[model samples]
Target: MSPKNLSALNKTHKLLLNKLKDKRTRQIYNKFEKYLNINENFAVAVSGGPDSLALSFLAKIYSIKNLLNVKYFIIDHKLRNNSTLEAKNVQKQLKKFSINLNILKWNGIKPKKNIQSIARDKRYELLLNETKKFKIKNILLGHHLDDLFENFFIRILRGSGLNGLISLDKKTQNNNINIIRPLLNFEKKDLTYISKFIFGFFVEDPSNEDDKFKRVKIRSFLKKLETEGLDKKKFLLTINNLKFSNETIKFYTKKNLLENTYFSEKKKLIILKESFFHHSAEVIFRSFTDVIKIVGKKYYPVRGKKIDSIIQLINNKSYFKVTLGGCVIKKVNQTVIVSKE
Candidate 1:
């Protein structure tokens, strides 16, 4: 490394450390420190929003303190005009702090309907691909408490079951990659403050305010409820209760799979004894979902409704074969067999 470049890097570090002397930044860092304990090199996805920009700073500081390397990436969906320019501007902003932000562009045709959902999936795909290229296992996201609350209400409106209701956790796996959301416990206000204090700006996505999106609608509805004196503390308590119940179901579901199912590694098949269906309905549903995902080799699990239908048919003692989520399932008298379709 050249001495000149090393000097600039030292300046960047000193600047960031100096910012931490600010009481507010220090407080946010302390709260952030309490949550993230990752010692391994990781990646952070930056969206140029307050939450993500704040995440870049906190994560950079974390990597610096732990002496671990971290990569920063942003997805350029190109859904709007001047998005490339915006991405470049964000890249420059991070470069000032010695954090190189890589932009991954979505090149295919964009969906007309379900734009947000497809964009989110593609964003993850792009980020995961970059992580794989770098041989990194974990990626940090900037979903804060507001997103968590909005997600719960959104899932409820979709008539999601127990597992779906609390699916978003601090840590989740997708496509064999670990997704870490370290800011779920922090509110948006704090993240916004950090972003402004550190970067002096953040890009506002217009889609956030557009009511056409379910998440936007839920965000608005939550504000209305807040006006009606809804207590976030109370709402958080409710979510915690639901999470506890979800954990219990997950526990039994694991037990059922361990005790009542056998997998043939060479044949890539799963055999489910009838006892697997004897657990509680939720446990059985969860167990079946896990098995189908494994046998199907799909990143996403099969639709819950379809999985429920298959389970119902198998429990009714029907001898039939059906295909779902790239998996073929059939019952043979006393056992259910699942294999790749």
Candidate 2:
């Protein structure tokens, strides 16, 4: 290797070491390392906030120590007037730490209503597109315990079922890539400390303070509840118990899918025999949800109410065909057939 490049590398290493001088920051980085013990290449979604900045620092340290490849990306949603500049500023700051960052833009039209929800989906879509292009199988996120709690309450407010309530797992499969959250057990304050001490700068998103958004409103409500003696430990325990129950239901769902349902070689068709509906309602509902998602190749499962309505149509003696969830369900003799619409 050239002497100049070697010297540059050594200098960057020294800077990273200096950032880790804080004992608490080092411990947090160690915990992050223990959680993300992967040797292959991966990418991190950096929003330039305290959470994502902390993630970038820890991921860089892990990559350097293990001789692995890790890329960083900032999504330029182009929502706000200064969004493009914000992305550039984040890129510039990380450059000082020797962490190279790429910017992905969201081009074209913007949503008028439900803006936050649509933007969130687009952000992941862009990030996952990067993963596919780079042939990487994992994408790390900056979600922490605070986000987890907020997601839980939001799902509840929307009348979510058990699956949706416990959907914020540490690791989940999205098509071929895995979405991992190593900091879900850590608090937001811990990450804030890392960003403040290491870089002394982080973006303060104005949307977080806007009460117009449901999430921001819930965050405020939770703060008040905490002051009113809400026990975080007990709340966490409740979520853990619910997760266990959800797992058991998932096991039965998988069993029913394997034992009672059959799929075509083309992977676009399914046949649920008459006996399929004989299982418990939950198992049958879950099994149907799986078939719809698989045949339709959709990222989300069909709504439960729609699935229940279809199940009713299937139970009828007369032949019936219905279309929903991008799939067509038809009854033939003693079996039900599902195919992409």
Candidate 3:
């Protein structure tokens, strides 16, 4: 073999080995690549942050080796004063790597209470719209290990059970689109390293540092705990255990859904038998909430006095109805009919 050919083969071998060495990266890439099932076309969501930027670079490299087609998206929320300039910078960086890019402008009204959440919803909407237009089935995100930890804490504080603590799935479907987070296994710090080393890329969002946001506050709290020599690994382990338990509960819940839930064009209802209701009040509440979710109504579990009230309504003999979080729960004829109010 020619020396140049041998050198090229060696490089290819090294690349393949590197992909296998990291379990998280390997798992995400494999799952996404298979889920996408496309040889040469996909859309990547890049905000030029350390996490997104690193994932973009990896996707670019992977595309070249695997004969995949890649397009990059940068959603300019226009909330920040310098958002346009930042988008331009990101475009320039992506161009240097020969990646095709699009900069989407957000012109919709922003939410009043939680600007971050509004921006996120808009961002995904824009990305999914573009992906659908481009006939791309796979959409990539930049969530990492630190994000999982932060979400775990946020859900815990919000009084969430197993589903919330399980955090996000490596791959999930949204509106017939496959959302994949390839960086879920990597830590934010590792992404930072990759960004600096490979692309000389870094992004600063002022909102991330602001203490007003719940996520920001939780991040700061976690950092303080780290400083205090708290075992983050053990904490995360506990969360993982809870997640596993939650998965088991979810399995049985799905079984119950198959057995008891009924869906129609106008409304969906779950028939909570006395046996199922007596399992665990927490599980029963979650099962009810899940039914509401399927019916396209957003419902959060009521707490304290509200929870007591819900329990009373469930146990009452006569018919009763109460509105909670845009959902109406009615008890009639030994069945609780949960629907949108």
The numbered model that scores best in lDDT is 1
Candidate number with greatest TM-score: 1
How well does candidate 1 score on lDDT at residue 50? 98
Query: Which regions of candidate 2 are displaced past 4 Å?
Result: 1-3, 265-267
Give per-residue CA lDDT, model 3, range 213-288, as digits (tens): 9999999988998899978678768867786787788777767666765555455444555555665666666666
Task: Please give the lDDT score at residue 285 for candidate 1.
Answer: 88
Tens digits of per-residue lDDT for model 2, 103-159: 999999999899997888788888888889989998999999889899999989988
Candidate 1 stretches with Cα past 4 Å from truth are 264-267, 297-300
Ranking by lDDT: 1, 2, 3
TM-score of each model, paired residue for residue: 0.94, 0.92, 0.74
For each candidate, how many residue pairs have backbone atoms clashing (under 3 Å)? 0, 0, 1
Work out how many backbone clashes candidate 3 has: 1
With a 3 Å backbone cut-off (N, CA, C), the pairs that clash in candidate 3 are 40-69
- Candidate 2 local Cα displacement, residue 340, angstroms: 3.2
